[model samples]
Target chain A: MKASYTRLAAVLLMALASVALAADNDNHQVTVTVNDINELAVTGGDITLIISSATAGQNPNQATDNTCGLEWTVNTTNKKITVATNQSSFAHTLKVQAASVSGGTAAAEVTISDTAQDLVTGVATTLGTCTLNYRATATAAQGTQSVAHTITFTITAAS
Target chain B: MKRILPTLAATAAIFLSSLGQAADVAILNGDVSLTITTAAAGQQPPAVTDETGQLEWTTLVTDAVKKIIAQTNLAGPSYTLSVRAVNISAGDGTGAGAVVLSTTPADLVVDIPSGIQPLDPGTCTLRYAASATVTGGAGTDNHSVTFTITDQ
Candidate 1:
């Protein structure tokens, strides 16, 4: 009984000491806001939130630099669009617009590079747009989540 | 340094996954080169009174066709290929009667013949036994037929 009393007294003393030495929690504040806003090409979400085809003044159709999908980039790497299903990021893009075979010989690619990656491997940024229209029968698809060609042109060149 | 937080993160850790992809199906939406041919080979041509209804079908096989070349892509469940004969410029009683064409190893869904199998894709041949009744024309004179085989 004497030994038990001694242990209890020691624990009590330690608890008091810890409370006394505790740092001020008033400065230890936390705030969380949804700022890493990333947009997805949803079906009926934002009308502008789509894989749109550039009109007469879109980016280069036959690009000299490397890119996929209309050469879009993310503002923050913190947030990412999780393709929950069997949605292929590069495979799911709207790229049938690249089927246009005129002006110059053409090629196409859909790539996922490291710079624009959020999930390391899922659907990252455009690694490289398909750049070889050997068969030129192109359609931008995400597994099966895709629409029809959003662009058209007359053919003069062969690729 | 601050710890990251997202209340509406839907799920945990906010990781992303997808149907890890590689686009393989190629949809070449260009003008497909459509070619038509016939299987009636060896040139065992039929003879008639007026003119030889060869490619330049002069005296057509009245009740039958000599041969035809169907130009089409519809494989099966489409229209069956057919070619009939009638003298565009006909005499009083002489005219192209009826013509018939078929694919060898005949099936309704005539698959375009790939040369791997020796069967011809299509054939146009005249059934001499089935004749177009012709009594008297300007003469035992000649004529021609242009058989356009089609799946339309």
Candidate 2:
């Protein structure tokens, strides 16, 4: 009985010593999650406007003519474009138009109300094509000069 | 009896010393991240990796498709980013109006060579390819690709 008791004491002492000498366990975690990405791309890197010389009465005027058509594409929930000009004074009446949309979903279209509108009228994931047209008055500056206008396109998450 | 006790104590001391000799295991914690710095409808210019590296296209465009280049700052004995497994994890589905990415020309299997032992962080660049079939609707869309980075 005494020997059995000694063995039990030895076992308990070893257990306690093992616990004391054991290395502390350290733990850490790394979580990786991917977020939804929204992106926009245009075919042509930059846009160019070509204004040709016309007769005093046959200029590319807003009433009956439009020119400098550009094609752009979007791939986002929604897109809007705003037009501005560097010409402080109005020697010639300049008009900008979102010509039309093609190659997109049925809901895709162009909005041109002299303000910002969807690149493709509605929100969609389809790759649509849009034509941007600019019209200038016939009775403009006499000399062959150039004026700069800015066309800014914006992408949004809204439909 | 006294001799037996001393022997048992010696055995216990030996076992505890062995535990003390064991090395502590450790691991670096954080996220390994990759970002496409420049890409277009059918083009992937280059990508920046937060893992101390950058990625670029091996070939600018092959048959109207752009390649992807991946680089990282991970000091490696060896590094690898899987090719066949590289794919779009989220975004517009890869269906009719979806943009698909691959490591091959036929939109099939592409064998991108892994980085050998790179001395510097951004020295190695792994290339991948991309293709897109855009239909009607137009808007910006986000896409993601998950690739494993192995340093051995």
Candidate 3:
């Protein structure tokens, strides 16, 4: 009986020792992480647009350079233009009439276009006289977010 | 002795059963972190060509249809502006030349009467081909543009 008791004690001791030598595995979980970021910012200095008034018809007698008309251009031709908003979401405009314009508005049309699409107005671009339309919608680059959006504004007799 | 033997056997059985009880176990824990930084920039022309500039069409008028071609600046946070290029000369009547744009041609729906071709066609009418080489992740660089074109 004493021998049997000794063997049982030995067995219990061996089992207890086995449990103590295990791994300290009390910590392992998946965590979220952030990677790289590229910031694309825009400012007035980054863009260049020149729209002018040129008097064309009434100045028939004047030199061609002195003609009253709309002289405009986009300087940042290297970049692409997006609506940054949606069509009819928000609009920017300027009013030029026979009175404000050197020449009469007998033949005036609103011209709107970019690198891809062209928008035309058959009649003068008066608020009630004609409809001012533009496509406005914008999004930032993939994995990016856009803030402080901007839209375009203009008034010209180009169309 | 037999009763004692059975009692010892019960204890041995209990201990053996307890020893056989092992758990296939896994432990999991983790740490998370987040960071945020921002760098922004803008570029544009202070003012456009408000003053009259010379565009001598003598070089473009090879025929009556070849009048002039030019682009407007692609301004951002865009502003509204009018652009006109007009020059006259006594030339052949069988031909009618005009100014047009690659993006928004002035003569697309051109009117000989008003002479102002509406800005219609594309969003970015003017373009300046450019190229750049970026060195560091955080550094400042600068560039300027001067564009001239003549097309008949």
| Candidate with the greatest DockQ versus the true structure | 2
Q: What DockQ, between 0 and 1, does each candidate earn?
A: 0.00, 0.07, 0.05
How does model 1 score on DockQ? 0.00
Query: Can you write out model 1's per-residue Cα lDDT over B87-140, one digit (the tens) per residue?
Result: 322221222343232223111112122221112112222221111111110111
Candidate 3's docking class is incorrect
Across B1-152, the per-residue lDDT of candidate 3 in tens digits comes to: 74676576667656664543321111112221211122222112222222222222111112123223333323221122233433332231112232222224333112112111222111112211211111111221121111122122
Prediction 1 global C-alpha lDDT:
0.22
Better of 1 and 2 by lDDT: 2
Per-residue lDDT of A74-153 in model 3, one digit per residue for the tens? 22112211212223322223222111221112223222332222122221211111122222122221122222223343
Per residue, candidate 2 scores C-alpha lDDT tens digits across B1-152 of: 66677577667656654554321211122233332233343222222333322221111111122222222222221112222212322220121112132232122112322321122211122222222222212222222233222111
Tens-place lDDT per residue, model 1, A67-125, is 22221122123222211122233343332223222212233332322222111112221
| Candidate that beats the other on TM-score, 1 or 2, i.e. the better one | 2
Alpha carbon deviation, residue A17, candidate 1 (Å): 99
For every candidate, the chain B TM-score is 0.20, 0.25, 0.26
Tens-digit per-residue lDDT, A17-81, candidate 2: 75454332222221122222233443344444445655576755334233333333343345433
